[model samples]
Target: MPELPEVEITRLGLMPLINHKVSQVVIRNSSLRWPVNLALNSILKDMPLVGLQRRGKYIFASFPIGTLIIHLGMSGRLCIASKKSAVQKHDHVDIIFNGPENKILRYRDPRRFGSITWTEDDPYQHKLIMSLGPEPLDNEFSADYLYEKLRNKSVCIKNAIMNSHVVVGVGNIYASESLFQARVQPHRPAHKISKDEIKSIVDAIKDVIENAINKGGSTLNDFFDVDGKSGYFQNEHHVYARKGMPCYLCDHPILQITLGQRSSFYCKNCQK
Candidate 1:
C-alpha cells in the first residue's frame, strides 16, 4: 500500500494542476475498494482545482464544488498523463484538466483497492478523515503527545504505533525501520517504555518519514512517484526485510518476527 510518504509525494507531483479547471472525469472502472463517484464529471466540470493536500495516506483534491478524496490502496498509482496518452489496462480513472497542455491526472490500480470519493463539507470532518491521528511529520505528533497516548497501553509498541488513532501513517515497513532506529524492540509493551524512549521513537518516526518522502518513498512493491520513479530509501534500511543479514553496527544477525501478523526485522544486539 502507498503510505503517507508516497501519498505526500503524489500530492507534490500533482501541484501543477492546482489552478487547472476540470474538463471531464472519465471512469473506466468504478468498482474499486469503494465505488468511484459516478457524478464526478458533472460535479467537477469547470471547477478549478484550488489545492491538493494529504492526510495520512489519503489525498484531498480541493475544488469549489467539493473535495475529491483519494486513497491509493495497495497497488494504486496516480500519475500525470497527456490527454493523448493511450489508456492502458488498469487505468481506471482520469481527471482531465482544461488547459493548452490538457493534462490528465490518471489513477491506475491493478488490485482495484484504491478509492475516489467526494464531499461537499469540510474534508477534515469527513468520516474517514475525522478519526485519524496526527500526521507523523506534523507538530501535533510531538513526543509529549505520543508518551501520553502510549503510557497506558499494553499493546506491543509496534502495533500501538501502527494504530491509526494513536498515530497515522506508521505502516509496517516504517514501524520496523523506526523502531530499529530508536533501538526499541518491536515486541516491547507500549506502557513499559520510558519517556525518553518515547521521545526517541517520536524523533525516529519523523526522521524516517521525512527521509522516505525525500527519497520518493520505498518501492518494495508497486509504489512509485507520479513520474513512475522508484523510491531509493529501501537502500538505507537498517533492519526492515534484512531478516538474517548481519547488523551493520554489530555482527549479530538481524532477526525477524511476526508482530500483528506483519513481518518485523530488528538487530538483536543493536536494537535492545
Candidate 2:
C-alpha cells in the first residue's frame, strides 16, 4: 500500500490540476473499497481545483463544492494521462480538465481497494480523518506526545508506532526502518522503553520518512508516482524485508518476526 511519503508525492504530482476546471468525470466502475459517488460528474463539473493536500495516506483535492478524498489503498495509483491516451485495464476513473492540453487525471487500481469520496464539510473533521493522530513529520508528533500516548500501552513497540491513533503515517515498512534506525527492539513493550529511547524513535521516524520522501518512497510492490516512476527508497532500507540477511551495522543477521500480524525486521545485536 502507498504510505505517507507516496501519498504526499501523489499530491505534489497533482499540483498542476489546481486552478483548472473539471471538464468531465468518467467513472468506469464504482466498485472500489467504497462506492464512488455516482454524482461526481455533476458535483465536480466546472469546479476549479483550488488545492491539493495530504493527510496520512489520504489525498485531499479541494474545490468550491467540497473536498475529494482519495486513498491509494494497496495497489492504486493516480497518473496524468492525455485525453488521447488509450484507456488500459484497471483504469477506473478519469477527471478531464478544461484546458488547451486536455489533460486527464486517471485513477488505476488493480485490487480495487482504493476509494474516492466527497465531503462538503471541513475535510479535517471528516470521520475518516477526525481521529487520526498528528502527522509523523509535523512538530505536533513530538517525543513528549508519543511518550504520553504509550505510557500505559502494553503493545509491542513496533505495533505502537504503527498505530495511526498514536501517530499517523508510520506504516509497516517505515516502522521497521524507524525502529532499526533508533536501535530499538521491535518486540519490546512500548511502556518499557525509556524516555530517551522514545526521543530517539521520534527523531528516527521523522528522518526516515523525510529521507523516503526525498527518495520518492519505497516501491516494494505496486507503488509508483504520477509519472509511472518507481521510488528508490527501498534500496536504502536497513532491515525491512532483509530477513536472514546480514545487518549493515553489526554484521549480525537481520531477524524477522511477526507483530500485530505484520512482518517486522530488526538487528538483534544492534537493536536492543
Candidate 3:
C-alpha cells in the first residue's frame, strides 16, 4: 500500500501537469470501485483541474464542480502517459487533457481494491476520509498531541499507531522503523509508555516519514512514481525487513516478530 510520502510525491508530481488543464475523463471500469464513477462523465470533461492535493493516502484532483478522489490500495499506481497511447491491462481510469500539450494520466490497480469517487464539495468529508487523523507532516500532528492521544491506551504500540483515529499513513514498515528509532519496543503496551518515550516516538515518526518522502517512498512490491520508476527508500531501511541482520547502531542481531499479525523488526538490545 502507498503511504503518505508516496502519496505526497504523487500529489506534487500531478499538481503541475494537471492544474489549470482541462481533462477528458475516461472510466473504463467502475464496477470494482465504491461510490461509483457515474457522475464522472458529467463534471470531469472540459473542467479545469483547480488543484491537486492529498489527505492521508488518498489523492484528490479538484475541479470547479467536483473533485476526484483516488485511493491506491494494496497494488495500485497512477501514471502519466501519452494521450494517444494504447490502454494496457489494469488501466482502469484515464484522464486525457487535449490542450496546448497532449498529456494523459492513467490509474492502474491490479488488486481492484483502489477506488474513484466524485464529490460535489470537499472530498475530506467522504466517509473514507472523514474519520482519519491529521497528516503526520502537518502542524496538527505533534509530540504533545500524540502523547495525549496515546494516554491510557492499553493496546500494543504497533496497533495504536496503525489506528486511523490515532494517526494516518504510519504503515507496517514505517511503524517498525519509527519504533526502532525511538528505542521503544513494538510490543510495549501504549499506556505503559512514558511521556518522554511517547515524545520520542512522535518525533521519530515524523522524521522517518519525511525522510521516506524525500527518498521517494519505500517500494514494497508494486509501488511506483508517476513515471513508473522504482523508489529507492527500501534500500536504506534500518529495521524493516532486516530480520537476523546486524543492527546498524549496536551490532546486535535484528529480531523480527509477529505483532498485530504484521512483521515487526527491531534490535532487542537497542530498542527497549
Every model's TM-score = 0.94, 0.95, 0.92
Residue 57's C-alpha lDDT in candidate 2?
Answer: 87
lDDT of 1 at 253: 93
- The clash number for model 3 is 0
Instruction: Kindly give the number of clashing pairs for every candidate.
Output: 0, 0, 0
Residue 45, model 2: Cα distance from true site in angstroms: 0.8
lDDT, residue 233, model 3: 50
- Put down candidate 2 lDDT per residue, 1-272, tens digits, no spaces: 77888788777777878899999999999999999999999999999999998888899999997999999889888988897788988999999999998879999998999999899999999999999999998999999999999989999999999999889999999999999999999999999999999999999999999988876634422343344553334557899999999999889999999998899999999999
Best by lDDT: 2
Per-residue lDDT over 2-103 for candidate 3, one digit per residue giving the tens place of the 0 to 100 score: 777777777766765656455567778775557456667666777888888888888988888888888887767786767556788888888887666667
Candidate numbers sorted by TM-score from highest down: 2, 1, 3
Cα lDDT of model 1 by residue, 1-272, tens digit: 77788788788878888999999999999999988889999989999999898888899999987898999888887988896678889999999999999989999889998889899999999999999999998899998999999989999999999999999999999999999999999999999999999999999999999888877734423333344553334558888888888998887999999988999999878776
Among the numbered candidates, top TM-score falls to: 2
Task: Give the poorly placed runs of model 2, Cα more than 4 Å off.
Answer: 217-227, 230-232
How close is each model in CA RMSD to the real structure? 2.6, 2.5, 2.8
